[model samples]
Target: MSSMRLTGTPSWLNIKQRSARPGGGDDPSRGPQEPVRRVWAIGGGKGGIGKSFLAVNLATVAARAGWRVLLIDADLAGANLHTCLGVRGGNRVNLSDYLYDRVVDIDKAAIDTSVPGLRLIMGALDHTGMAETSRAQREHLFQALRKLPVDLVVFDLAAGADRATLDFFLETDEGVIIATPEPTSIENAYGFLRAAFYRRLARTMSTSPIRDLIREAMDRRNERGIRTPADLFKEIGQLDRGEEARFRQALEDFRPRLVVNQVRESEEIKLGFSMRSVCRKFFGINLEYLGYICFDDAVWRSIKERQPLVLAYPQSDAALYIRRIVHKMLGT
Candidate 1:
């Protein structure tokens, strides 16, 4: 059997074999600590592209592979990830509760799942005002997450490139942008990347005079007639070497990964590569291609059953596709 180390002890999950009172009281003997885990945020600009579906199944697959996984439903406004995981009870606390009430510690809100190696942190049901988290709140949430025990933490983010969404996306070690083969999905994905890049650059220059200059250069009405991020970077290179270096480093370090879903034909698969090219040429962004998932009836069936496809059909093409993605993400 495969086994992987986890980071922190989840409040919800109590591994039967691992839970023992050392002194037959509240105090317990100190033992070995789990290794810190990596956090990944899965998002897409447009809705209905299967972002939640992908996030749930991916976490399930990781759990099956013997890695303790914590799946966070970061989609505040329309948080349905609980339903996807077959959690049918009321949540005492959620992301909204933590955001709105400083007294509520987010760790107290985690929920155990039927799966052996997986746990879930539900998001806000009515997140109308909860999405407006200050920078301090965001940092607080991240700090709390760093203490969670899991080999992998996946955040199923809302579908958009709004300031809040972009902030959370940038906070994670890696972000996965899910897109379909459709034209609209592709266009929105590009727009999402542009917005994220600009937001990061704007934040990076919070106290610098070059911030205004960069903003003007990126503006559509500028004399340079720059419409794309590549054009803006080119203009910066001509003006100041320091600014150019900063811009280039941002572009290189902000390498977001891509996953093409619901693909059918070989031609449709080609769109993934074309997107990578367009991103490099027009946007000057290098995106890691994480592979594609073919349209499969079994996937829909698994969803209907409220189970992950990797568990329902381990040998199916869709499961294999997910395995490849995990491999790529792990660089194995």
Candidate 2:
């Protein structure tokens, strides 16, 4: 039996502590709290990259290991994660209910799943306004997520590099980017990383003059010609030493995990490493290659049956790879 466990204060808790409100450490819930230990957000630049498949199976695998898990569909645009988890949605309270104040408690939106120790909070299905959630609303939702009575919370974020999507990706402890071995997918993945990297840098700069420069660099067509993060850092180093140090710290701290799905040939399996190298050389980012899942017929079959692959085909090659990825995330 695997002795791997994911319970306890997460490695990123120290970073959270630094930004935590003063004297806001205690849980105010009525009873003992089952504080969420880790959060994983699975997202990509484009749709159809198997993000939902990966999220559902990862949540299922963690739950089966006796850890309480909450799989939330953060994809407000196309909320089908309920279907992926084989849960029927019929007027059940969901994320929008909590966001829009229909439900005061986020726990009310939790729906029981077939897998024990696992629950789900469905995403907005019809609320078009959810895509434009205000910053306060997003922060409230994130605070509630930290207090959910589960060991892990996995967010199935929407596709694209929109501000809302990048915020969700940055807020989580583990930000996973799923992509395929196709040229278009790779291009979009790079775009997504650039957007996210700049977003993080902007958030790190507090009241600094370089903050405006970061914003300008976000626009690729800016007259400053600051195309990459390296170029921006070079400009910042010439401007202010204090801001330059902040930029260096943020660059070192921002590490996003990557997983290539539907991989087939050996070269495709090596795509993760190639991307990692390119990120280091071109973007000065440390991208962790968190293993990949091979192309398998069982993946689609599980989707067709509206069941998580780990549950529908536990013995399938895809399931095996998914479990391995989960273990890697757990650092076991």
Candidate 3:
């Protein structure tokens, strides 16, 4: 397949051409049906933590595995996934168009990537207002995303623990948090995880009283003295004994995956395990330590070339580790 570029015409809307098997991990012998779609969102609390790089390479690896993939750059203000995939930026329709009602169908914003079986929906690169869309608009976007025709949809979220980013992360089948071993990144990761867990609990609770209590707990300096999710659960149990079961269920459901990036030493990889332990003990949330990627020069080289590391340096150590991470995610 040739690389897709934005032209003066509106023909980019019909750019779905797969060079590999159409169905993702489905039995081709069976009768035709819609591919089983899976969604994963990659996010973090700190900027410059390599979330986009990981998202691009992960989508490429999945596409190479014969899964039709749609990678969406959900980072409205900091959009750069298109550049990562070697797609030109100018005059192209993007996610902002859909949110602002400039485009009626979400598929119209999806442009073909150089990688076969993989396409990209560029973020609202030049639209600062996109970061402040209403909840209704976001809901509409999520609903439209579900109907997208693809085996997998990966969202590269904007950095931070903002409500919009967290909502996108929580809505996906698998939410992966990417962080480095730096002290600041680790701290922000914990903060992001905390915000996500509280958000989940607030949404899970039906009673206004319980939700108000959760909101109180979310404030670090609140008079309630609720410093952690475990503390919040205790208060919830005391406030409404019948809600304990629901609270526990919410805790059981919020399992976010972690990926430690740019590891310079073997000891740095253990950060994932440490964060997992902290989440289990303090927040009562089961954070899965998906895997880690070691620092490699090939990563920078591929970025300079504007190609995915998996395709540009498949033999490099970082590339091997990335493919391993993808396999672990797919259970293959």
Candidate 4:
């Protein structure tokens, strides 16, 4: 956890950890994994929001951009990132293999895909509920992954704002939340931000007097006007003066990037602005709208052909949009 937050602004993505190899030299290639790691976890509030698609293209684009990329199919429920990258399951070892005893080291699960400089550590090959991972297992995974030799690690997380998902989202160097322009999708996205915001205070509130306010707020057991984070914090400042500042500082580390996908018109693209405004109002948070993606027919075609849009049709609208996002993420 000491290496969790890099700094303010884009310093979050500049995480670089160097450690002595087991043998003693500063050799970066001696370990089973990378010397340092930058994990970008892609998640959303609801399902079918193109999380995997965005993840695939980002990995492909970053790989083509000359960075060693490792894409993990962290979508434990339906781990299908391999299909997007066109990596067959016959010969490759997945996270299931590592978790089930086929491989002890997580790095050994990484395999080079068709995309140059890109590799994958796929999740449950059979998709038999890998989401039930214990926190200890996730911690172990994080520790092992942070030591990888790769430059970037992209985790395609599962849907919803569950604790497991939030933990993964928080642990990463960068967190990306994908949402469409639909009303339901937008509401879920807001719900996710609310959950993440409260989650930021959870560890502290569990013991502080803020715990009662949160519990009453959740159960409607109190009429303290704690409908929003701002209201709750106002109450907290009255209850424990210094804890309010501590709680605020805990939330400062959470800077999740937003992406409005499936946009058909320029008007729909502005949903990011509205969403960002809503996040600030409801959760007292600011979202970095990285960019938007147009809804492309070629996306479906790529899915049908089991090829990544960035590779199959580089000039396609979806491919270009994904490239822009990748560049923004890389700060290049």
User: Which model scores highest in TM-score?
Assistant: 3
Give me candidate 2's TM-score against the actual structure: 0.89
By TM-score, rank the candidates, best first: 3, 2, 4, 1
239-300: candidate 2 lDDT, tens digit per residue = 98888899999999888889899877656877888888999999999888887787888888
After aligning candidate 2 to the native by TM-score, how far in Å is the CA of 174 from where it should be?
Answer: 1.0
RMSD of each: 9.3, 6.7, 9.2, 7.7
Ranking by lDDT: 3, 2, 4, 1
Each candidate's lDDT (Cα)?
0.73, 0.82, 0.82, 0.76
Q: Where does candidate 1 stray beyond 4 Å?
A: 1-35, 127-130, 214-224, 238-240
Report RMSD for candidate 2. Answer: 6.7
Per-residue lDDT tens digits for candidate 3, residues 118-235, read 9998987685744498878889988887776677889998888888888888887488999899999999889988898888888889999999998999899999899988888788
Q: Estimate, for each residue in 1-332, the C-alpha lDDT of model 1 and write its tens digit.
A: 12111223223221112212211112344332442356688887998898888999888877776667788888888787887778864745677767667437666777887777788888777746325778787778878777755567888888877777888788774788989999899988888888788877777654465677667755658886878877777777777788888888888788788889887765676677788888999888887676777777777777788777788777777777776677556543
Cα lDDT of model 4 by residue, 219-293, tens digit: 333577678877877888888877888778866767888988988766787788888787787777868888778
For candidate 4, the per-residue lDDT at 169 reads 82
Tell me the deviation in Å of residue 93 in model 4: 2.3
Q: Candidate 1, residue 259: CA error in Å? A: 0.6
List candidate 3 stretches off by more than 4 Å: 1-36, 127-130
Error of 2 at 310 (Å): 0.6
Model 4 bad stretches (over 4 Å): 1-34, 90-92, 100-102, 204-223
Clashing residue pairs in candidate 1, if any?
Answer: 7-150, 8-149
Q: Model 2 clash pairs?
A: none
